[model samples]
Target: MKILITGGAGFIGSNFIHYWMKKYSQDEIVNLDKLTYAGNLSNLRIVENLPNYHFIKGDITDKKLLEKLFKKENFDLIVHFAAESHVDRSITDPDIFLKTNILGTHNLLCMALKNRTRFHHVSTDEVFGSLKKNDPAFNEKTPYDPRSPYSASKAASDHLVRAYFHTYELPITISNCSNNYGPFHFPEKLFPLFITNLLENKKIPLYGDGEAVRDWLYVEDHCRAIDTIIKKGKIGETYCIGGNSEKSNKEVTYKILALLDKNEKMIEFVKDRPGHDQRYAIDFSKIKNELGWEPSVSFEDGIKKTIDWFSTNKAWWKSIKNGKYKEYYDKQYANH
Candidate 1:
């Protein structure tokens, strides 16, 4: 099979590419990435010269380019992972989020419809908004009440995917996953930020009271789940993928600190993000029962592997920290 994956240089995307290449030797992969501040080619150094893998530098918002590539490659499958994902960045500049997450998604949908290609969209459980302590976890049937520009844009894209399925008979499957942490994760996110800070003996910032909860999944497990869904998921259906590991932000930070031999004293309370969801959890029974998929790595094991990766690959992240990442941090968090 010839497959095309957008945002293949980003964290989860890169991991998925590696997973797929190892699992299917006969399959060919075309990786499309815009090489944004968060997207780094260094993540895919292992497969840079693989004959079955090809990398293309481009943006999903470029409709003409997308059309040309679809025609040229005749790819049978597409995994749409390209988007502006950080909530803080979205709060500061929502225009890019709208263009990338909403319009970029629509562009992919148009191409899929035109080519009648099978497409899978990677989404987040954040679109369900905050859950009450006793509230049921998010499922495929959950209503979307996105709280931030990031989630809102993803929600809009989700709607577009479903609309295409109904209007044009597009073969598309969507999966809404929870917090993912593993190797190659950009440092701007919670796990990497805390890990890097702990290494530097810096204070770990916890937004609000640090009670905000999320369901955390290892990126490799997520990649496997996506692979399962793409191969066997019923078209026009949405699935929720999660670790079933729920923890408050405070708890997660403390765990990471412990792993790094640090103390809870490093915690620093920061102003909460606007529209920050108080909690997020997912009911992933659908995928588990239907696709026979479950998370292979435990939270403790996954976090340790992630921490070790960040610790050993300092040069990879150090370059990003010193370059465009610093500017992005300054521009996005300047007000905070």
Candidate 2:
């Protein structure tokens, strides 16, 4: 199959590319990435030389570009993962998130419909919003109650996907996954930030006592789940993919510290983010029952592997730390 993967250079997308190239020998993959701060080419070094893989540096909002590429490639499948995913960045500049997450998604959906290609959208469980202390975990049927601009924009895109599926009879499947952590993760995210901070002997910033909870899934497992959904999932359905590993920010921070043999003194509490969800969890029974797919990696094993990857790949992140990310970090943490 010839597949177009939006944001293929970003964390999860790049990992998915790696997984697919290894699993399917004859499949052709096209990567479309905007090369945003988080989208680094270094993540896909392993597949850069593969004959079946091609890279296109572009934005999803560029409808003309997307149309041109769609017509040129005539792709059979589209794995849409491109979006502005950072919650803090979304809070600081919501317009970019709205433009990319909502409008860009619409643009892709429109292109897919016009091209008559099967589209699989990768979404986050954050669209289901915060879970109350007594509330059940979010499932495929959970109503969207997005709290942050990031989640709200994604929620809008999710609605658009469903609308296109019903209104135009577009062939589509959606997967809402929980928090993902694994190798090649940008340092801006929670796990990577804490791991890199500990490596640099820097203070790990904990927002608002670090009580916010999230369900963590290893990136590879999430990719495999997506593959399963793409291969066998029913059309016009949403699947929730989660590792069933739930932990609060505080618990995760301390766990990393303990794993790295660091002291709790490395942690420093900071002001909470605007509209930070207190908790997020997912119910993955649909994917498990329908596709027989479940997370294979244990949380402990996944965390250790992630920590070791970042620990050894200092140059990969250090280059970002010294370059483009320097400005963002300076601006965001100036108060701290």
Candidate 3:
């Protein structure tokens, strides 16, 4: 199978490329990334020279580029992952999120339908908005109530995917997954940011009394779940994939501190970002019962491995932290 992965240089996309290549030796993989601030080429350094793996630096918002690539590759499958995914960034600047997440997805769907390629739209549980502490976990049937600009854009993209499925009879599967953490994760997200911060003995920024809840899925487990959906999932269905391990932001921060043998005093409580979801949980039983898939890595184990990766790979992340990655954001998100 020949597969094209958009946002392949970002955290999950890069991890998925590695996972796909390793699991299916016969499959060919092409990576399309815009090399945004969060998308790092170094994430896929291991497979950079692989015979079946190809990388293209292009934005999904560019319809002409999509046309050219789709025509050239005639890919069998396209995994859509490109987006302005960070909520904080989205809050400060929403137009980029709208263009990249909504319009870019529309472009991909149009090209995929034209080429007769199966599409898998990668999304986030944030589209369901926040859950009260007692609220039932979100399932496939949950109505989207996006709060942040980021989730709103993702919600729009998800709706577009279903629209194409129902109206055009396009072959597509959507997965709304929980927070993911693992290797090659850019340092902006909580996991990488906290881990790298502790490595440098910098204070950890604990947002909103650290009580916002999140379901944490390891990156590898999420990748495996995507593969399962591609192979066995029914078209036009949405799957909720999660780690089933829920933790408050504070709890997670302390766990990282413990893993690194650091002190809790290092936490510096900060004002919470607007529209910070109080809680998020996923009912992944659909994927579990149907696909026989569940997260295999325990939070303890997965986090430990992640900490070790950041600890050892200082140079890789050091380059990102050395004002190089910040320069991109400075140019775009100049105000915030």
Model 1 lDDT tens row, 225-324:
9999998999999999999899999999989998999998998787888888888899999999999999999998998899999999999878877887
Q: What TM-score, over all chains together, does every model reach?
A: 0.97, 0.98, 0.96
Q: Kindly list the per-residue Cα lDDT of model 2 for residues 237-333, writing each as its tens digit.
A: 9999999999999999999999989999999888898788998999899999989999999999999999999989999999988898979987887
Candidate 2 residue pairs in clash (backbone atoms < 3 Å) = none
Could you tell which candidate, 1 or 2, scores higher by TM-score?
2
Candidate that scores best on TM-score? 2
Model 2 quality (TM-score): 0.98
Cα lDDT for residue 279, model 2? 88
lDDT of 2 at 44: 94
Q: Please tell me which model should have the higher lDDT, number 1 or number 3.
A: 1
* Candidate 3 residue-wise lDDT, 155-233, digit = tens: 9999999999999999999999999999998887899988998899888777868999999988999999999999999
* Top candidate when judged by lDDT against the true structure: 2
lDDT order of candidates, top first: 2, 1, 3
